[model samples]
Target: MDELRRALQTRIEAGTLPGAVAAVASSDGRARVDALGVTEFGGEVPMRRGTPFRITSMTKPMVAAVAMMLVEDGTLTLDAPVESWLPELAGRRVLRRLDAALADTVPAQRPILVEDLLTFRLGHGLLLGPESDYPVAAAGRALDLTLAEPFPRTPYAPDEWLRRFASLPLMYQPGARWAYSTGTLLLGVLLSRASGVPLDDLLRDRLFTPLGMTSTGFTLTPSTAAQLPAHYQAGERQDLSPPSLWTQRPPFPDGSAGLASTVDDVLAFGRFLLSAGADLLTPSSVQAMTTNHLTGPQIESAGILLDGSGWGYGMSVTVRPDDISGPGRYGWDGGYGTSWCNDPATGRVCVLLTQVSDIFWNGTMPEFLHLALRCNVPA
Candidate 1:
């Protein structure tokens, strides 16, 4: 753990990351948090434990938990057609080919199930196209969808967002391919509609309140906002507009790629999931949520960091263990440089927060993962 702390501080001093905070925990509730460096370059405000991180796609797991809450109560069923709750997705169309023109399409063979959203199998997602100017990127930009390469500042309201998103044909039939991001966003809308409340409010009531995750939310309070740092991409500072997006209400309270949280809050979430939902979910539900949902071929590209793991509801479940992390560990990383893993086998939960986009490119995140897992055991 001492060496781990020094490595993080060394990176901060060398300016690889503007700032970082991490929390590591064991199933017995023992945990340790580390914060290092200044929040901005050539600035004096040092990073602290309370600093809020733009947790990006890490929000998916929490949103997934909310959906499971509804499912546990019979408000939603796993395999049921989501059209009953989300009308905008009623009759989806699929593109004839992934790179085909917008007009080339076919009707969907089956309704997108509620399960598809949890499993990221609703087809369309941020497909890493062969080129930067891929058609999927252009189509999403055409819809003004805040896909967050630069980090989402403003967003279309949920209804308008979904309608515009639905305008693009799904890349494949429902459940045919394990797409990512879009399904989680759709789940936010579906859950909100099913519960008769906004997604933010719904999460606050069912997830944040129940778990005591007081510092987690799509928007932040003024105090919490003060602790956030500038975003970085490819080692350069990436600016976002309406700076208050973290402090106040955003145009869209995104379930897929929004939410800011502290290391404490993230560790709290890890604890809850490791505790088998700790009353927020049943043991069976937790098992199902953390279980691998992908088939043999679908496991190939769930993510870059978690390359070969099978995805579960929002996180990736390891089918085979890596060198440092073992199988049965589940969690997701964020585009805005945040990651968390809950290892049920070792009873370890590791969370790392930073402000750099594509933090994986620099190898710091993976190094941290290895160190943290190696240090999981007590001295």
Candidate 2:
């Protein structure tokens, strides 16, 4: 734990980041938790284990778990088309070319399956590189889909957001390739519609409550808001103030990137995954959620977003491990300075949270993750 604290403290002293909170547990029932540095670079408040963070894409795995619960209850099926629940997506169109106008398209080869959203294969998402400036991206921007970061909260409600999204053509045919972000957001709306409940309430009832992740949710209440630190970036003084967008319930409760949570809450969720759902989910369901579901060609097409990992339900599976990690380590990183992974082989669960978005790209995140992986399980 000294080594871990030293690593994080060095970064803080060097002005690389403000502060961080981390939690880890191993198969032998050993565990450790630590909080280091201040809430912000020069802020008075110190980082704490319970500090809430806007977890961005880390929300995916949790929503995926909820979907699995619905599946187990017979409310949804992996193979069934999602059109019955999200009629806006019933007749999707594919762009003839990414550069082509939105009107130039072919009908989808098949309706999108529930599994497509889980696996990010629904074919509609943020385009990367030059394709991001293509017609699809332009259409998304026109609709204010706000797929990428540095975004204000979207004003449209879930239904309207879906309607705007469905107006555009998909970049590829259904299940053709992995597209990031959009599928998970759409999945949130689908879940709400199918269950006849709002997404926030549904998630609380199904996942957060059961997992004891009381601090994890779409909106930060008065209690949790007090725990939210000021968000920061590498060069920027402040990315988001404490009482920011997260304090209010966004019109769209995006399952892809809408939740704020604490290190302990995220650790609880990771522990649940490590425990193979801890009786909340069947072993087979947990296996499906964590297993690599992408084919070789699909993985190749996903490129940098997936790097070498394979997409599972809504998280990345470590198909290709490095020196610090082994295969079957499943989890996702949040764009907003947080990461969570459960190593099934070693039975280790790790959660690292900070308010600094720069860490996600500035090498600090990778350094912390490696340290967390190597840190001894304190007896």
**Top model number, lDDT:** 2
> lDDT by residue for model 2 over 1-379, one digit each (tens)?
6788888889889988778888878866678988888877678888887788888889999999999999999999999999989888888889998888889999999999999999999888777766445978876887887776524667899989988988888888999889898889889999999999999999999999988888888888776677687776666766443565666777888788888888878888888888778878998999999999999998888888888889899999988777659788889998777888988877888888886778867887778778878778779
Question: Candidate 2: how large is its RMSD?
Answer: 1.6
Error of 1 at 85 (Å): 1.3
Q: CA lDDT of each candidate?
A: 0.82, 0.85
Per-residue C-alpha lDDT of model 1 across residues 1-379, encoded as one tens digit per residue: 7778888888887889777887788888788888888787778888899888888889999999989999999999999998887887888888888787777889999999999999988887777755344566577876778653425444578888878887778888999888778788789889888999999999999989887889988887877787788777776777772346666677777888878888988898889889998877998998988999899877765555358888889888888878767688889989888989987777889999988875688888888888888785453
Error of 2 at 178 (Å): 0.5
* Candidate 1: worst-modelled 10 consecutive residues by lDDT: 146-155
* Model 1 regions lying over 4 Å from their true place: 130-136, 148-150, 301-306, 376-379
Once fitted onto the true fold, the runs of candidate 2 whose alpha carbons sit more than 4 angstroms away are 130-132, 238-244
